[model samples]
Target chain A: MKKSSCSLLILVLLWSNGVFGQDLLNLLEAEQKDENQYAPSAFMMTRIAFGHSTEVRPQNVLDVFVANRFWNTPEESTQSFVADRMSSRIALEYAISDRLTFGAGATTFDGLFDAHLKYRAALQRNGDGWPITLTLFQNMSYDSSPIADQSVSDDFSDRLSFTSQILVSKRFNKNFSLQLAPTLVNRSLGLSAADPTSIFALGAGVRYKLGPHVSFVSEYYQVFNPLESRTTFDPIAFGVNWELGDLMLQFMLTNSWFMVEDAFITRTPNNFNFRNPNLNFGFNATYVIHFKNKLKK
Target chain B: MNKVLLLLTTLVLTLSNDSSDKVICRQGSVSFFSYTSVENIKAQNNQVSSIIDFESSKIAVSMLMNAFVFEKALMREHFNESYIESDIYPKATFEGEILDFEPAMEGAQIRIVKGLFTMHGVAEELEIKTKIEKSGSTFTLTGSFETLVESYDINIPPLLAGNIAKTISVDFRFEYEPYEEK
Candidate 1:
């Protein structure tokens, strides 16, 4: 009886192994046909947007822009430009993981700072047939100036601001995707009575694929401050992203440009006198290179 | 009973024959190109592999989603987290076979492959041209194809539409060694 029972167990084990093996094999075959058939060596995208909105009150139209004159021309001065009536910024993004990314950029009218850090985390994915993504982002800005003057009390300083945003995006098709982010802003320093670190902002953006190497992007953001009576700021931007093998270029335009905290945060046109103020209009450009490591699969 | 025996015998022979074919794929430095004019932005997956059994019309392929490195690491992260959701669906696979395969010389030859490809939980019929090369104790296979992201329900954000390509092309080359039969 013991021998018979042992044989039965062996038979069952063999049968189950065969069944499961076949199932696994079948699954493997099926999965091969799915999207992204190859284990990609790496993925990258360069983005840019350019757009502008006029202030509702003509006198309130303040544009802040920061320009890098020495960027493309060797003879150009290294000093940055400051315009308080209109602005623009250009940024480049890189993906470190499937859910996290790092980004840096420079703006036209905000401040002299030429870089920032952006970390995004995906809380949910649209894998199970649902075309929705929930993501959280933390954007931090650094001061651009080497000189530190506490008396300056400009928006650009040794300060840190945190933005908590929830993003929901849906790909309408392979060529197009749309996303909406509702965010809460918290700042360590308050520059104005109208500047509420706890203001609410809304962001809407879209991505469209045109071909194998190019795409277009656009985004709009509106921030509403409840503490400051009837104070709101709307910034719009549009741009084009070009990918050349390993190199990516992004170019964009806008009316509220600043690279660092003080550039846009303190010098945005909304906070300055609209009339007889500096108005700057220009584009921001970014280039990126990717490095990849091979994996043994 | 005779027919059942014959079927079992054929299955055994086919299985044994497949054990002799192997396929390996690798991607070292893959790249992506995004163009606004041609609207041809594409991320190329360099690491891809698969094995095929000509006698049985069976095939298997596998890839690591995280392996897709990008020029901008941030974009890679967003793709894994926000787009492909790499944590939940870490890898993509295909398990199917050529509908009709006839054994040929032990070297490279052109062959037609037909099978069902499942992606993003949806399965679709795929007919592609494949090259099979057999050299003594080794075999190699190569194939290329393209797929529309919409077919798999991959959504691109409107703000990002201009940067991502609608159709992604897939190219593959595999090297295999015989699996010694016991």
Candidate 2:
């Protein structure tokens, strides 16, 4: 009787494995088509702190961005509750295609107007498909600040600057991502006669996700060759990003006073030191709008 | 000796029934719509997989949560990251039996499909009214159902609660061909 019961138990187990309804579902799942899944949210927004990340706005979408920086001068009254000076930048960015994005903005402190074109060359996949994301960025800025020197500010070409960068990024996991940007800057006329017309810099950025809607972001740019005529320091910023439904808000601290890449990456004069009170409190807000239905199956 | 023979015969019958009575759909479509005063969001996934077993009147549906395509890319990102948390629960599935389902039904027949629908690591019993059409060797099944967002443990923060609907409507269609193991 024991032998017969043992054989019966074996039969039941084998039958359950093949004949159960769950097995049918498993079979269907096994034959499901393999779909390409791309890594999502390498960076929460287009800007990682003060520098641009390897992210492009979606096609046919418009982004309205506003950034502000506030700081106190050394001679400012200590009685003031907060910073005494403020700088702001307002921008409108639009994605023409899935891989191409363009934006233009105006800044208040330097009276600078800037425009940029970004192209996404490659996107990282979820698994082992593509290890890194690659993007190319080009920006042009015109200084519109009122200057007494006619030779410096009168000519449109002399007041212009250009920046070119290749942004390479990798999303190691859902919570961490890293990016490196090799940059080249060109100025029609340097601020000082001894300053070089061209500058080379390397920027690094990191994002650590704390939650689905929040992340800690930091960026640093190191100039290869410093300006000979003026004291220049590398730009560094750290911030927290909060994402709402259609808007993103970033709060940051940085030693750079400028908003645009042409000015900040090459001309930042303050060092990010613990003892120095050079850090500026800044915030950025971005709103996105989708123009039309561009869904792809 | 007779008992051993009986066990072997039952195994052979079950294995043969698995292949002969099954129909499969590799390219099915499932779409969901959320209507709200603030915004109306809609997404669709065409890479759904489903199977129907006529011998047992059983049906199964499986789809990748990340496969859903929304009108806006940001909406898709939010759906995966915030709403469904696709990293933790990558697939949504349904396994159920068809009531009064006849493989030899002449024309379009309306049937009730009762199943456990699982999404976002939560499972709930569901009954969907489906329209099934059989012509030659092809079987087409189409249906729509309404499910509450709360039933799936999907939490929308109070601040953005007005942007999404409390209840969502889902529609699906599958065209099944004869299953042949490749």
Candidate 3:
């Protein structure tokens, strides 16, 4: 009788395993078709100080931005803290997917028209595998204004400049995230007649949350290129980001009047010494709109 | 040793028999709606899991907090990253008993479920009205309840006080089948 009862239990277990798993498989598959699929935004703000962040917006979402940069540096005299020379950039970005984002803008500085595409290459979870989040950013720009070296940049290709960066970031906790970006800028025609066509730089940024809607953000770039021949100083920025619903507003003290990666990374005008109070005060605002397609399944 | 062996055998038999009285739902669905004069917010999660024991009148449920999806992508992000903090509290769960519940062979009954629902690392006592539909072998349960967002310690800023409702309404439904140990 004991053996018979044991056999009966085994049969019930086997039957239930097959039945339960199969039924659940079917239900899960059916639900997945209509379920929402999305990932988290690593950074709260849209722009990580004149460059794209590792965070990618969700699909079918558009972000419109206005960034104003005042042309001055803190190393100058304190008489002109907020300079009158300001360049404005209006950019619009759309997320093709959770992994890829594309944007285009026009900067008043150098009459630059720029476009960029940033992709989230890999995401790191808290486990033994994949320790860091990696992102790839590429920006291309064309200076439409007249060039001093007309003989070198007469052609359209000569007017083009590109900046490619690899952003490596890690979210240490809810309050802090750190990022390191190895950047490369390639200009078909260098600014000076004797300058090299390409230059390399390292960029670092940090975001620390102070409240639910406010965070401290900053970024610095150190160029490895020769300082003697360099026409522009390295970029330094310190800012605060305020998030409210779908809108984000940012105010910063920076050293450049450029808002695109190609323009800002290679052509800032300030050093980190802060010898004087001639800091350029700027502000940026971004609003995101979501599009939903519910008419058809 | 012999007594221990006999006791183990008896326990295994009892557990095996209890499996027939135990109902499990792996694809249960839970949703919530918040309506205010200024705005209305809704989210749903279909990956919820629940189990009910007919003999013991016990009910338990668990679901991933990140699985909750909203109609708007930004809302979903805020729901996980801002409000729920899915990274820290990845799952929400509930364990409760049906007060004065008596199993029926093939009928429907109204019951009260008294339990502790835990979300965002906070737990609160919940009492919800539930409708249980039982057939020969299939069982279906549906319920809805109202709770305050502050009970879960989720802070809403004053700026958004008008957009989000003061009280939230939660809804749950599950269809259960006899559980298989394997």
Candidate 4:
């Protein structure tokens, strides 16, 4: 009887082990892991309105941008409608990696060609990890317009201007974001005698998301020292961004006519004050195409 | 002395039984497709985790939503940020029993599985017809099912309503190996 009881005990132990061992769900939970949780949708596009935002394109993606600005001065009577002068820009931007973007563009306003390289230094986290997103932007522009003024030199090196900026942005929530860009501009030939060889300006931008596909954006640039030889006003813009499938459109009213960073920040002649508004109507359209295969995370 | 030998033998058998009951799959594949008049959208995720218990015929699967790769980067962004809200709910899970299944079956056999599928913080009862095969100590499961977008509380904007279908088709396959603690 003792031997039989011992055999029954062994069978019971073996059978119960299989029935009550670790659960399948618990085993799956143990093997499941998490990837890095980065914040999403800081800004819809690479640009908030008229300037670069702290956003970069994904790797091996191409972005085509077409921008047009229309403005008319009350002093010019030759104009039939609101827009007597128009300037346009066409640009192509590509992402070389997850953190680096390169772009080149041509502008009709000053017969200028511009190129830029942007690097994303750090990205914000989804939670209490990282507080802000940081990006570095560098741009170079060459002016090829006919020498209309004798003071302006025709030397190719003299016509070149450069801009370097550190972009810092914080997305407070899904609907609101703010950005600040401390900018440095260098020009061999100044816009005016009072304009220094190097200019310092602070740029600010804000976005309020209305929906998943639309947002209201605005930007302003404040120069440290005003130009004395020619009257200049700080550049200010208000715009709305609308995103459709693969295309994004920006409708804006601004005081800056030039599309490049150096010219728009230092040489804007119009003021955005409501009393004597010198706002130019601008429209920008961007379309993106993927050139590489999708990579799994 | 004989009782002591029986007790030692019982402990060894119990440990062996526990190890043999569980199997795991680290690289299961799950893909979904949506067909509309405007376009066909599809995505696939290969890094799915799954485990099955032979003793109870229970299975469980877990997957990260962001791991799904789409043909277009923009579409992937929209799927995560706008539709699925992957940031808010990062993972989807399912746990259920494989009914009418024989682990000792030599070849592929059809089985019915009923489970609770959870995604986007919403849960629904799901039933799938699967073809299961057991060879040696390895098991492979293949199945397909249809799920409604509205049932998961996913909202599509009016403008993109025509671009997406009401029902999405999902197909999955998992090849499982005997589970061993790493």
Which candidate has the highest DockQ of all?
Answer: 2
What TM value does chain A in model 4 reach? 0.85
- The top-ranked prediction according to lDDT is 2
Best by TM-score: 2
Model 2 Cα lDDT, one tens digit per residue, A108-142: 98899999999999998876687899999999999
What DockQ does each candidate score versus the true complex, computed on alpha carbons? 0.10, 0.48, 0.17, 0.37
Q: Model 3, B84: alpha-carbon shift in Å?
A: 1.1
**Candidate 4: where are CA atoms >4 Å away?**
A1-27, A75-82, A128-131, A275-277, A295-297, B1-20
lDDT of 3 by residue, B88-137 (tens): 78778787788888766468889899988889999899899999898877
Task: For residues B23-125, write the lDDT of model 1, one tens digit per residue.
Answer: 3333322334544654444455666555555444567666666667554443565566456755546656676665446555766678777766665556667
Residues B90-140, model 2: lDDT tens digits? 899999999999999867999999999999999999999999999988999
Residue A162 error, candidate 1, Å:
4.1
DockQ of 3: 0.17
Score chain A of each prediction against the true chain A by TM-score and list the results.
0.55, 0.91, 0.78, 0.85
Candidate 1, A45-107: lDDT as tens digits: 322243211001011111122223111112334353543244445455555544455545554
lDDT at position A240, candidate 4: 97
Cα shift from native, residue B140, model 4 (Å) = 1.6
TM-score of each: 0.48, 0.91, 0.84, 0.85
Model 3: chain B TM-score vs. truth? 0.90
Candidate order by DockQ, highest to lowest? Answer: 2, 4, 3, 1
Name the DockQ score for candidate 4: 0.37
Error of 3 at A1 (Å): 35
What's the true lDDT of residue B145 in model 3?
A: 91
